[model samples]
Target: MKSQLLVPAVYDFLENMEFEGFDQFYEYAIKRDVPVVSKAVGNIISFFVSLFRPTNILELGCGIGTAAKYMLTKSKANYTGVDNNLERIEVAKRFLKDFNKLKFIHSRVETFLCGTDEKYDFVFVDSIKKDYEKIWYLLKPVLTKRSMVIFDDFFLYGYIFQEEAEIPYKYREGVRLIKRFINNIKNDPTAEIVFLPIENGIMVVHYEG
Candidate 1:
C-alpha cells in the first residue's frame, strides 16, 4: 500500500533508493494485487533488523516472502513466517528456499501464536487490519521489551484519517478498528508505539511488560 501523501520530490527520493532484487517481488505483488509490504516499508524493517540483529524473527501474514527477503538479506537470524493461505506459504517457501534458517507455517496466526511458546525478538505483521487488536493480544505472550514489532498498512491507503463517509464502504470498519487499536495502545502503560508515515503508515510497537 504505497502512500500518496508525500510530496513529489520526497516520494521520488524514497522510491529511487535501490533494494536491488526487491523490485521483482514488488512488481509481482503489484501485478497480482497482493498485499505485500512496499519496498520503502520493507527497507525500513530491514534497517531495524540490521540494527537490532535479533536472534529470532517472526513474521505474520508473510505474503510471498517479500519483506522476509528484505529483512533476512543482511542478517542471519532464524526466521519463522505464519500465513493462513497454504498456497502463499508454498510460494514463500519456494521463493525463500535459499534461506536455510527460515521456515513458513501454514496456519492461522491465532492458532500459531497460541501453540508456540517461543518468543521472538523481532516481528513484522502485514495482516488484516481489523484483526490487529486480536493479533496484538495474542502477541503479548510472545514479546519482550527488547522485541520490535512492525505493523504495515495502518493508514489504510490514507483512509484511517478520513471521515466515515470519506472512506470506502469496505474499508471504513477496518479503519475504525485500527484507530481504536492505536488509541488503546497509546493508553497502555506497558506498551510503546511509534508511527512512521512510510508507505501507508507503519506502526512500530514494543511491549515493556
Candidate 2:
C-alpha cells in the first residue's frame, strides 16, 4: 500500500502530542517489528473508554497490550484480550500483570468468542478483515445493550478504495473483505457507525438492533 495519509493535517497535529510512559513499549514494539496501536488510535480509545465507562471491555487481536494499557489508563474496566500469537500474548500478560481485572487468553478470536458465555460492554477489534463478519455475528449474543465496537485498519492502508489491479496480490483479498465488512455494517438497519479518517481508519460501530 502507498504512504498516503488518511488525515495528513490531523496526523501532523497528533504526532506532536506526547505520550508520557508509552515510549518504552512503543520502542520495544518498534524493535520487534510488532504492530501496536498508534498514538492517535490509543487516544481515541481512551476517549471512548472515558466517555462510556464500560464495565467489561473485550479486545480482539491485542498486540503486546499497548491498547489495553491505554484503555486502562483512561478507565477502570475489566478487560479480556484474545489472540493466537503466543509471543505477543506473553508480552501482553507480562506488561499488564499489574492490572487486577486484566486477562489475556491465547486463542483464536472465534474460539474464545464461541466458547465463552461472558458479555462485554465494549469491544475493540484489530484482527483479520476476512474474519470480521464472522466475528461480528458471533459477538452478537455477548454484547450488552448499546455496546460499541471499534475496528482498526478499516481503510486497509488506503488500498480499499483502489482498483484490484492497483493493489498487490497479497493485500487484495484483505481489501475486498474489509470493503464487504464495511458495506455489510453500513447496510445493517440495526447498526450505527461513524468513519474516522485517522492513521489508517477507525470504524466505530454501535449495534442498536
Candidate 3:
C-alpha cells in the first residue's frame, strides 16, 4: 500500500532479483496481507550485514522471518527475532528451521528488549508505528556504541507526507508519530540518523553520535 508518490522505477529495478528460499514466506505474507519488509529493504539490510559482518543480530517485529532470511544468509551471526504474534512466530520457525543459530521468540518488542542482557551489533525493527518512540526508549538499553538500527516503514506508504485529511483515518496517528520521531531524533545530540526513501522508507541510526 505504498504511495506511488515517492516510488520510482528504482524499486522495481532493485527488487527484480530472486531470493531463492524466501519466496514461500513472501507469498504467504502477501496473500495474507501481513506487513513484511519489502525486498528493497531486505537488500539494503543484506548489504549492511555483508559490509559489517556483525556477530549478533536482532530483529523486532519479525513477521514470518522474511527479513531474517536475508540477514542470516549474509552473516553467520546468531539471529534473534522477536514478534508479539504467536502464529507468525510459529510460521517463521517453520520456515526458518534450517538455520542453525536462529532463535525466534514470541514476545512484545519492548518486553524482549527490557529483559535481555544481550548486545547486538545490528538490529532491524519493523514494528507498530505508533509504538516507535516507546519501543525506542526501551531498545537503547540493548545496544552497544557500535549498534546500527534500521526502522522500516518510516514513510508509511508515503502517507507520511500527505495531508492529514488525505491519509486514511486508520493511518493518521502513525504518520503523526513518525513526524514526531523524525523531529525528536534530529534534535537529540546522541543520535546520528539517516532517513532513506527506500521502498517503505527507512530510518537508519547509530546509537552514539
Candidate 4:
C-alpha cells in the first residue's frame, strides 16, 4: 500500500491556501514545465516558519524562488536561496525583486556551503536525493542553536521503502543514498528529528549541539 501521508484530498485542501500573487507564479511554473514545490509542501514550510519564527533561512535547490517567496512572506525572515541553474535563478530574481530580505545565488550548493561562514536558523534542502548526504555534512557546521534543517521528498514517491529489486534500475542508486541519509540521522546522537507526513515526506532535524 502507498503512504497515506500524501492523500490527494489532503493535498487538494492545502494547495488552495492563498498567498497574494503566489498562484500567478505557480501557474507560470506549471505552464513553463519547470520544477517547483507543490502547494502542500509550501504550506508545510509556511507552517514551520510561523511556529519557529527563524531569523535566517538558507534553501538549497531553490528553483525559481517559489519556496523562498513562501518562506519570506510567511516568516518575514532573511533568506539566501542557492540554485545551480542560472536560468532558474534569473527567473527567481525577477519574481523576488520586491523582497529586500531575500537573495538568490547562482552557484552549486556544495560550493556555496564551503565558502560561507554564516550560520542559519533554518535550512531547507530541496536538492536531489543522492546529494542530500553530502549537503548534510557541509550543512552541519553552519547550524546554530535550536536550528532546524528540513529535508524534502524523503519518501521519494514511496520508492524509499521498496525493495531494491522492485525499484527501477535507474533510480536504485539514488534511492539507496536517501535511505542511507535516513539511517544515519536515525542513529545520530546530536540531532532531534521528526518525520512529518506532509507531501511526499518531510524530515526536520533540530541541532542539539
Candidate 5:
C-alpha cells in the first residue's frame, strides 16, 4: 500500500495564518519531519478547548503533537496524547518536550483504553472511526460525570453519512460512523450531544451531571 503524501500547497496556505505560536511550531515540525495539524482543524480545536478549558484532556491519534502543542499554548488543560505509530510517537515526544504536563502514549487507542485507569475531563477522538464505538465503550468507564468528548473528522465538505465521496475512504466511513455514534450518544439519558461546524466537524458530547 502507498503511504499518504503531504500536501505542501495546503500546508503553505495554512502556514500563512497569524495564529500565535503556530508558526514556530509549524516550522519546528517541518524541520524535524513531524506531522503538523491542518491549520483549519487546529484553529477549530483551539477555539473549542479555549471555550471549555477542561482541566484534563485526552487525545486519540495525536500526530506529532501539533494539536497537543496548540492545546498547551491556547488552553490550560493538561494533555495526554495517544497514537499506535511508534515513529510518530517519537517525533511527538521530542516536539512536545518543552511542555512538562503533556504526555504521549505509544499505544493503540484500544490497548491504551484497556489498561488505563484514569478518567479525563475532556476526550478528543480523532483516530480510526471503525473503532469509534469500541473506543467509546472503553472510555465510558474512565470519563468524569461531566466530561466532554469531541469526535473529529466526522464530516468532510458538509456531507454526512456518505462513505464514497471524492475524499479518503476512511474519512468517508468515519463520517458515517460518527453520525451513528452521535445519534446513539444523544439518545443516551446520561449525555448531551452537540455538533460544532468546525474542523471538518466536531461532535461534542457531554456526560450529564
Candidate 6:
C-alpha cells in the first residue's frame, strides 16, 4: 500500500505530455529529495490552468520551489512562491536560478498576506492542513472574479496509517477541517469547487464571475 506504486503510473503518463523545461526540473526534484508537487498531478493541474494563462500566480508553502519552477516553465506565468523555511527557500533559489520570472519569499504565508499589496490571478495553497482556512481567508479578499485557487493534499492518506492503533487525533481533525473548508467554499457564491483525485487530491476552486 505504499504510494510509490502510484508514482510510476503517474510519471509514465506525464512523461509523454509536452511541457518545455518541466522534465528537467521534475527529474532534478525527484533526485534531490525535494518535496514538490507530484509530477503527474502537478502536470495535470498545470496543463489545465495553462489554458487560462494566468498572468500572476502566487504559491503558498513552496517547498524548494519545484512546483513554482514547473508552473513558471509550463504556464509561463509571473510566479511568486512563499515558504517559512529559509533553508528550503535557499535551495529553491539555487535550483530555480534560470527563471527570472519566478521569485521566492522567506516568510510565513500568514505574514506575507498581511503586507502584500499585490493581487494574483491564481493562488495556490500548499501550506499545512491546519492552516488552510487561515490562508484562504487571507487571500479571499484579493481574489478576482476569474482567479483560480488550488489546494493540494486535501485527501487523507488513508492507507498510510491503517494499522496504527491510538492514531493521533490531529490527523482526523485535520481531515475534518479540510472537508469543512471545501464545503464552505462550495457554498459560497464567489467560487466553484472541484476535487481532483491526483497525488493526494487537489481541490480546485475557480472564482465566480
Q: Write the per-residue lDDT of candidate 6 for residues 25-60, one digit (tens) a residue.
A: 567667876667766666766675677789889989
What value does the lDDT take at residue 44 in candidate 1?
94
Residues 10-64 of candidate 4 have per-residue lDDT tens digits of: 6777767777768767887879988788777787788788899999899999999
Give the Å shift of residue 83 in candidate 3.
Answer: 0.6
- Model 1: residue 100 alpha-carbon error in angstroms: 2.0
The C-alpha TM-scores of every prediction are 0.93, 0.93, 0.92, 0.93, 0.77, 0.82
What is the RMSD of candidate 3?
A: 1.7
For residues 1-209, write the lDDT of model 1, one tens digit per residue. 44756676777788788877776677777787777776678789989999989889999999799989999997999999999888777878877888878888989899999999888989999888899988999998898666888998878888887789888899988988998998899998878889998878889987677
CA shift at 43, candidate 3, in angstroms? Answer: 0.6
Q: What is residue 67's positional error in candidate 2, in angstroms?
A: 0.4
**lDDT of model 6 at position 24:** 59
Model 2 global lDDT (CA atoms, 0 to 1) = 0.86
Candidate numbers sorted by TM-score from highest down: 2, 1, 4, 3, 6, 5
User: What is the TM-score of candidate 6?
Assistant: 0.82
- Per-candidate total of colliding backbone pairs: 0, 0, 0, 0, 0, 0
Cα shift from native, residue 180, model 1 (Å)? 1.0
Better of 3 and 5 by lDDT: 3
Candidate 4's C-alpha runs over 4 A off are 1-5
After superposing candidate 1 on the true structure, give the runs of residues whose Cα lies further than 4 Å from its correct spot: none
Per-residue lDDT tens digits for candidate 3, residues 94-146, read 98888889988899887898899998889999988888888788888788777
Candidate 2 structure quality by residue, lDDT tens digits, 1-209: 22255456767778568987787678888799888888888999999999989999999999899999889998778999998999998888888777888888999999998999999989999988768788888888889988999988778888888999999899898888888888888898878999988888889989775
Those runs of model 2 whose alpha carbons end farther than 4 Å from true positions after fitting are: 1-3, 7-9
